[model samples]
Target chain A: MSQGRERVYINDVAPRDGLQIEKQWVATADKVRLIDGLMATGLARVEATSFVSPRAIPNLADAAEVVQGIRRVSGVGIVVLVPNVKGCERALASGVDEINLVMSASESHSRANLRMSPEQSLAQFAEIVDLAKGSGVFVNGSLSTAFGCPFDGEVPQSRVLGFIERLLELGVEGVTLADTTGMANPAQVARLCEAVMTRWSQVPFTLHVHNTRGMGLANCLAAWQSGVTQFDAALGGLGGCPFAPGATGNVCTEDLVHMFEQMGVDTGVDLAALIELSTTLPELVGHDVPGQVAKAGPADRRYPCPAGL
Target chain B: MSQGRERVYINDVAPRDGLQIEKQWVATADKVRLIDGLMATGLARVEATSFVSPRAIPNLADAAEVVQGIRRVSGVGIVVLVPNVKGCERALASGVDEINLVMSASESHSRANLRMSPEQSLAQFAEIVDLAKGSGVFVNGSLSTAFGCPFDGEVPQSRVLGFIERLLELGVEGVTLADTTGMANPAQVARLCEAVMTRWSQVPFTLHVHNTRGMGLANCLAAWQSGVTQFDAALGGLGGCPFAPGATGNVCTEDLVHMFEQMGVDTGVDLAALIELSTTLPELVGHDVPGQVAKAGPADRRYPCPAGL
Candidate 1:
């Protein structure tokens, strides 16, 4: 039997990654209410919004208003995705607790998504880190398509490791390895997570996986068995990749918490509260979200015997 | 890293378990075609149909015709669920390779689903075994609610082991531990699977799981890591429990095969062929199925860069 971690930390990225691609415009008030509802559920961190170009992602245009409107809890971290030094400046001015810088591990994905090469993205990240150095805001770097790219089939583990080294050297405090297109399998997740946990023992690494192919929970189980203590999930499984159309988004937060809690691991989040919050997502997004626990209830839920049986 | 089993065996139970719960009646020819298509995908076994009372499960009322109409492939076992000596006689006369006997481990589930106590079910199983003893037919006993039950919250592991011992003593050749309500978590699956593997080293054990709470693939991963090589899956994630309304049915066969194959474990089945067959399920069932690989494609599927990127 594998000696899995005893507890896990989860960052709900629904407000940012989950909503950025949505066609309907979520009002600024509704976005704040959603983030605050998530925070009330005791999430470790909430990726409130992304301070990217509004022209590129019009849905999350009110990133600053969202960050400023949320009821900041003392222990909960409010994170926002920042694209460059300009976005970083906006996020810091909004009094965010953490600034999440973005980059891609694959060349084609880097060009397609960010409109910059990997090297160019790294140079921008270095400038953002320098800008946020003395501001006391935690710096997290999210490496998109770290597992595989839609255009470029596989991103080598050695290349991912090299980028991690560069990100840390640029004064980034934490790193998130994102399976942007839901291409990661359990064995591969275990191998890569083990490699990072072994090499960067002191650095905190988070796994961000999509459920496009239905291996989301299995990949999370593999990563947990390999000693990963932090994860990135979206409420109602809300995020999707523009490149992989018809694909589901990140692993659902309530479902992931249900799995871990059922396995006797502590996630420090109220599952019932999370599920209750997830029910309002359809109205918020104008469509159904992919979360299952909310629809199916938790595993511990019992049913009455069939009538007359 | 877990030294998981090198190869896995899959039994597609869509024809029996998946179709039995459907609200619409599936035509016998379509059922035969589905089973034949699944077998042609190089599956190790296919549960063609069940010989239960038509009043209880009308969808599978054409059991004998389904068993006789399917093109028998060499090296692929054709199995059927037999509820009593009558079902066993019909299945044996139809020239099936295996007869599956089922009973619930939980008392409430046993009474509610099968309308019999555990002891009564065991007695009936012994009678069927005696009837099929000299027919050269393999006896496979399936213990439903082996993990947890909807009416009775948790089924103890020790109680499950006792039932397995009884099934073996009754001349059962193999056993399937079923999570009837999708109540199983990965830790529970790992513990039960490891116990069974350690105690009954020679007996072939199959895991039957549901995706009700979204832990289906995770539970499969745990069971696989605990030395389980045989799995029971339904094509297109068909099937649901009558007790747990709104719950999804058996784990998707195509999704499971995709996961195992992507992990570099040999499943001995053609995944692309399986997915191709999954596309026809919506038209056959008159509804969209829940399998994701069929919707999103496999992990290795590549896409061209977005226009102008």
Candidate 2:
């Protein structure tokens, strides 16, 4: 564990990851408004959209328009998920500030998710990192299904560490170990984080957790204790993996920030403003959201008199 | 820090603490049925019912009858929460195997919640423990708002330890440090649990966590690393503090057991049965519960169609 006060960096993933799995098609303007609202809460980075083929993720069909339509507010960096060299080109053209490359740590999930072997995925990562080298955009390599795989069962920690070593060598600015299938617990998270931090103490790692088994926050706490602070969260917990059947959305950003702030750990995000943004999600996405604190307010807000309703 | 394997004990609190906060009035027989169902989940102990004044908590008006009606399932110890000597007398008369006496660590919350000072509450604990000693009933002294209190703002760790020292002097089994409003983060939880365990390593401490701020499981995981094993959870996260505004339930038993089981920790509780219990809670309590794992299956179960729900 790091020997000082922990600094928490929250990456809001509402626009891209949150809505990608949604069957409903949200408008480009709504997506822009969502990113703007998320930025207004003091989050420095927001995953604005995915630069992928529309046929692959039809929910994010208007990625380019959504990116172009958003008013570039200062201090808010927009990031996009790029699958390969083609997606990286689209992301660079969209003027995004950062690009995230994802591959599964589990071989079975890697094959099913990206349709490539582990070595091929590593090669793809190298290619994308090389392309984005001097593009003024940051790179984050995400290792999905880092805890356990739906198809391959429990993934060995050694394999995940090997992938991280390769990605770090590729010169990616950050790495995210995702509980893609929501199979992580505190022990596994602690063990994995210990292994990773022991080898690379200076490597910045982000946690992408899901509340599928209700261990989302627990696993997150384990990682925090092990010195991983940056997190990817969905507003209203509005995303999930289609490959993992029972998986839910990413850990709710508002809830995570609330927890951090209450304990005197500065998240630099306003809880009340985040709650207000949470209300705008339903109208923007055309569906109710899943986050509990947004629907229920913060921990100490009193319920209004029943007659008020 | 705990050495070797840590054995986890689950304390089901759905019957007493859970039903007390609901607006709907459950019948006495239904309360017994809920208790029976919880006991069948193989919980080491189940909080049967509270013997508080009906005017104070109308939901448990028939608390004595409900406690008397539950079949004494073999190997399951019954626990009941008591506010004073009178409540403890009634609980002991109802054949409760354990008596849980609760007081807030924060004086402000104690005044609002229990209508007493911290000193007055500890004095009451001394009397209650003295009375229960001759009856062969175990007493667990719980300090609410141990992490942070709503009215008092931040509760200092020293105040919690002082309460523990005073309570330990009384004839009680152990202390339960509660995050009454879920204001605990991983750091705060780890610090508090470490301090407490360092002092009373052999004492039977349990964590009574609420999910109000979404740090319930995180705090639980921190406590686990600090050597806490016994936890008090409701069936479907169906309880909240009667006095603390906007508070949610205790960590759900099914959710907690699922987290531990996925991490390879032995909880000795069944998740499938807990989920079955979770589904029936809405019907029993006259409203839907807050647990996500029950509605969403375990993370690995695959639905027939992976293409979006």
TM-score of only chain B in every candidate structure: 0.98, 0.94
Candidate 1 per-residue lDDT, tens place, B1-309, comes to: 448478999999999999998878999999999999999999999999999988889999999999889998999999999998898888889999999999999999999989999999999998999999988999999999999888888889999999999999999999999998899999999999999999999999999999988888999999999999999999999988765555678999999999999999888999999999999988988888888999888889888887787
- Give lDDT tens digits, candidate 2, residues B77-183: 89988999899888888888889899988767777778778899988888898888878888898889898776666788987898888888887787888887766
* Model 2 accuracy (lDDT, Cα): 0.81
Name the runs in model 1 displaced over 4 angstroms.
A1-4, B2-4
- Superpose all Cα atoms of candidate 1 onto the true structure and report the RMSD in Å to 1 decimal: 1.1
DockQ of each: 0.76, 0.36
lDDT, candidate 1, A9-79, per-residue tens = 99999999899988899999999999999999989999999999999899988888888899989899999
DockQ of candidate 1 (2 decimals)? 0.76
Estimate how well candidate 2 is docked, as a DockQ score.
Answer: 0.36
Candidate 2 chain A: 10-residue stretch with minimal lDDT: A300-309
lDDT of 2 by residue, A225-286 (tens): 77887888888877876654444578888888877775666777888999888878888777
> Each model's TM-score, in the order given?
0.99, 0.91
